[model samples]
Target: MVTRGTEILVIKRNDPAWPGLTFPGGHVEAHESFHDSVVRELKEETGLTIKKPKLVGVKQFYDDDDHRYLVFFYTAHDFSGKLKASNEGQLFWMTKDELQKQKLAYNFDRDLPVYFNDNLSEHILDGKRDELF
Candidate 1:
C-alpha cells in the first residue's frame, strides 16, 4: 500500500521482494479490510499510527524473472509515532519528483505518477484494469 502524507514513505524490503525504495505495504490478511491492511502494514514496518488511509490506486507488476505483484495503494494525512529503523529498511519522505529519480523497484516507475494526479474514485473504478508498468 502507498501511505502518503505530505511526503511519501518508502522502505527497502529485507527479503527477496524488490528491496529498495518501495511503498510501505504488504499482503492483505485474512478477514481484514484493505484499509486496515494499510494501517497495519505502516505500523508494523514504520511504527506509525495512521487515521483514515485514503485508497489511491491498484496496479500490477510483472518481471522477466516471472515475479509478479499486485498492490493496493493508500494515503494517510494524519499520523503519529516515531520513525525507527525496522527490518523493512530505512524510511524516508520525498517529493513526488524525487521519487521518480530513485531506483524504485520497476512498477513504481509507471504507477505512482498516475496516483499523484488522479483522484481516489478514478483509481478505484478504473486504475487496476490496465498494466501501468
Candidate 2:
C-alpha cells in the first residue's frame, strides 16, 4: 500500500476472482525477490515509483479445492511519481476510515488492517471465497 498523507492507494481490478478495490500488485517472476516484484507491479498497475518499500506480511490463501496462493503485502511510506491509471483500472486514495465505507476486493479486509494498525509481522490464512474454486 502507498499512502499519501492519511489515504492509501488502491486499484479497481478488471479480472475475475477477487476483482474489485485492491492493492496494485502482480505475480512475481521466477528468481525475483518480493521487493523487486512489488516495485515493478506498482509501476505497471499504478504508475508509481516507490522508495524504501517495507514488507508488511506474507499471506497464504487456501480455497475449497485445495488450491493455494501466497501474497506478499508491502507498504511504501515514501515514493516518487505521477499518478497515472493503466489498463488495470482506476487508482485512488482513501483514508482508513474511508475504506470502511467502500467494498473491498477480497481478503483486504482481513489482511491489510494488521499493517494499518502498526503490526509488521507476517501472516498465513485460508481464504473465504463465495464461489466454487
At residue 85, candidate 1 shows an lDDT of 60
Local distance difference test values of all predictions, in order:
0.69, 0.78
- lDDT, candidate 2, 1-133, per-residue tens: 8998898888888878768888888899999988899899988888789988987667776877888887777889788888899988888898888876788886677776556666445456654442211
Clashing pairs in 1: none
List runs of model 1 lying over 4 Å from the truth.
Answer: 1-6, 61-70, 119-133
Q: Residue 53 of model 1: what lDDT?
A: 87
Span of 10 residues, lowest total lDDT, candidate 2: 124-133
State each model's C-alpha RMSD to the native.
Answer: 4.6, 4.1
- After superposition, the stretches of candidate 2 with alpha carbons farther than 4 Å from their true spots are 127-133
lDDT of the structure predicted as candidate 2? 0.78
Give one digit per residue, the lDDT tens place, for model 1 in 37-108: 888888889888888888766665555665766677677878888876688778787877677788887455
Clashes of each: 0, 0
